[model samples]
Target: MGNAQDKPPGTGGGGGRSDQATAGSGARGRAGGSAEKAQTHKASEKRVANGRENSPAGGQGQQGSPAVDTSYLDAPSGALPPHLARLKNEGNHLFKHGQFGDALEKYTHAIDGCAEAGIDSPEDLCILYSNRAACYLKDGNSTDCIQDCTKALELQPYSLKALLRRAIAYESLERYRKAYVDYKTVLQIDTGVQAAHDSVHRITKMLIEQDGPGWRENLPDIPAVPLSVQQHHREKPISVEVAQARAARAAQEEVRKKEACFTLLKREGNDLVKKGHFQEALQKYNECLSLKSDECALYTNRAICFLKLNHFEEAKQDCDSALQLEPSNKKAFYRRALAYKGLQDYLSASSDLQEVLQLDPNVREAEQELEVVTGLLRQSLMDSSAHTPRV
Candidate 1:
C-alpha cells in the first residue's frame, strides 16, 4: 500500500494503532485502549501466579487475591490495526487511481475485519465511511453516497466532510430541502468556512427554486446548535467600568487590524482580477468579505468577478449587497444591469441602465447599454404580443 502522500483528498487516513491518542480521547476510543491494557494486566497477573507456584513461597498471596474476569479479553482495541491499515492503504491507492469499485471492496473488507475484531472506534468508522462516500460520489452513485455519509455522521455527528458530502448527494438527488439543511449545519459548525457559506447560499436558492418563496418553512426544524463550537467566540464576562473601557479599546484596535487585513486582501483580489484570474480573485474577495462583511466595495469587487465568470445570479446577489450598503453606488448599479442583461431580464436591465444614466448622463457605456436593452425589451414585447390571443 502507498503512503499518506499518495492518498487523495477525502480519502486520507489519520490515526491508526501506531498513533498516539489525541486530546479528545473519547472520540478516539480511549475506552477500547483501556480494555486492551486491562487484558494485558490480566496476562501479567497470570504470569505472576505461575511464578508464585514455582517459588518457595508456594503462592502465599493467591488465596487472598480475588479472581479477575477475562471474559472481555477476546476483542482487540478499536483503533485501526495493522491488517486493516493495509486494506485501507490499498483502497486509498485504488481510489486515487479511479478504481472506485476496487477501492470500495478494500474498504468493505477493512470494515468487516473491524467487526470481527470488535474494533468500533467512531472516529475510525467515520473515516472509512467518509472515504467510501467519496468513492460513491465519484462513481455518481448519489444513493450510496448518501447512505455512506449518513453512516459516517451517525458515528461522528460533527463530521463536516460527511455532512458536506451528504449535502452534495442530496443535491444530486434533487432533494434541495435536505441539501439546504445539511449545508446550514456545516455553516453552523464553522461560520468562517467559505465553501460551507457558499454551499448554504447556493442550496438555499435551489430550495427556493423547488419549493417557491416559502421554501424555508418546508425544511425540518433545525436542531438546537451545540454550544461547544461557539465557546471559542465568546468574550469574557465584564462588570467593572474600567475593565469595560479597556475592552472597548481592545475591540477598536481589533477592528483597525481587521481593516488593515481587508485592505491587503482587496489589493490581492484586484491584482488577480487584472491578471484575468477571476476565480482566484473571487476567493480573495470572499476572504475579504469574511473579515469585513458589510464592506460595500468588497461586494462590488466580488460582483465584477462573478460577472466575468458568467455567474450572473451570483453577480446580481453581490450587486444587491453592494446597493444595500450604498444605494447611490454607480458601479453597483452598472454591474447589476450587466447581470440582468446576461440573465435576459431586459426590463430590469433597462431600469438599472436608466438609473446609471440618471447618475451620470455623460457615461457613454451606460448609454450604449441602455440602447441595446431598449431594443431587446421592444423585441420581447412584440414576440409576446404575437403569441397572445386576439382580444
Candidate 2:
C-alpha cells in the first residue's frame, strides 16, 4: 500500500506541475463557488478547483503565497468523453469536499454513460476496468480488485497497470511466484521499468537464499509490457471466472514446474512440493512464513509440526523464536512452556507457565500446569536447601 498521507508528486493525484497526472475516481458534485459563466479564466489559470495541482497533495504549497487560491469549485480529473466529462466534473466537485463514498457513485454513473455510448472496445473497456479496479483496491476489496484487474487484462493482455495490480493481489494472497513472474514480465515489456525489475531481483534472490527450487529459475520470461496480440477480429471479453483461472494457473504453473518457493517446499524438499502437487491447508500457512519470518502464528504452526514429529528441542526453539518476535503472544508462551515440560526442563517450563498466567489468567490449562510445576520446584528447592552448608 504505497498510499502515503497524500499523493506523491508527479502521480497527478494532487499537487505539482505534471501535465500527465493520475486522477483517482471519486470526484463529483459538492457545494462551492461558481464553476461556470463570468469567471475570469486564464491560461494556466489554476482551474484546479478540485484539480490535482490544487489537490491535497499540492495544497500545502509555497508558504509565501498567502490567500489560498479559491478560484474553481470542483475536483481535478482527466477529461472524459464530452457529456461524461461534465458528469465526472460534477463528481469531482463532490470528491473535493471529502465525500468519498458518495463521489464513487458519480464516477460509476460516468462509466455507465461511456458504456451506453457504444464506446465499448477492449482498449476502451480496459481503461474503465483499470479505473474501477483502483477504486476497489482503495476500498480494500481484494476479490473485486482481482476481478477488475483480470477484466482489464482480458481487454489488453499486456496492460502494464493490470499486471502491476494483479501482482499486488497475488502478493496479498501469498502467491509470490506469480508476483515474481509478473514483475519479470513487466521488465521485459519495458527494459527501463526499473521498479518491476528490482522487485523481481529482490524477491527472486530471497527465494534462492532460502534454497527455493528451480521453478523460479525456469519461470516464463514475461515483458514489463505485454507484446501486442494481433487483434484481427474483435470478440467479447472473457468472463471473470476465466480471467481468474488464467491468473491463478499462470502463477501456479510457474511454481509447479520447478522447486517450490514456499517454506513447505523446505519441509517437503522437492518430494510432494513439486509442480501440480496439491498442498494441504497448512501449506498456505507455511508458504506465508517462508516469505516473511516475522509472523508469530507461522512459528506456532511449525512448532505444532515439530511436536507431532516428537522433536521437542526444535519445537521449543520455534516457540522461543516466536516469543522473541512477539513478546505478548500467549499461544507461543503456552506452546513453548509445554515444549519445555516435554524436554523435562521443569524450571524453564515453570517460568513460561507463570508468564502465560500473567498474560491470560483464565487459562485452566496453564493453571493446572502451574500447580503441578510449583510443587515440583518447591520440593526440589527444599532438597537443595537441605544440602546447602549453613553458611
Q: What is the C-alpha lDDT profile of model 2 across 1-391, one tens digit per residue?
A: 1210121111222211122122223221111123331132211123333342343333335655555543433333344464455445544444555544434444455555555465555775565566555544444444555666787888888776677766655555545677688766655555545556666776677567654677556555654442343232123375465467568867877776433556554455234333424334236546766676786777886776666566789889889889899988988888888788778777988999889889989999999988887787788788889999997
> Model 2 TM-score?
0.35
Specify the highest-lDDT model's number: 1
Error of 1 at 388 (Å): 96
C-alpha lDDT values of all predictions: 0.70, 0.57
Model 2 is weakest, by summed lDDT over 10 consecutive residues, at 1-10
RMSD for each model, in Å, please?
Answer: 24.2, 17.9
Q: Model 1 — TM-score against the truth?
A: 0.41
Off by over 4 Å in 1: 1-78, 229-391
Measure candidate 2: CA RMSD. Answer: 17.9
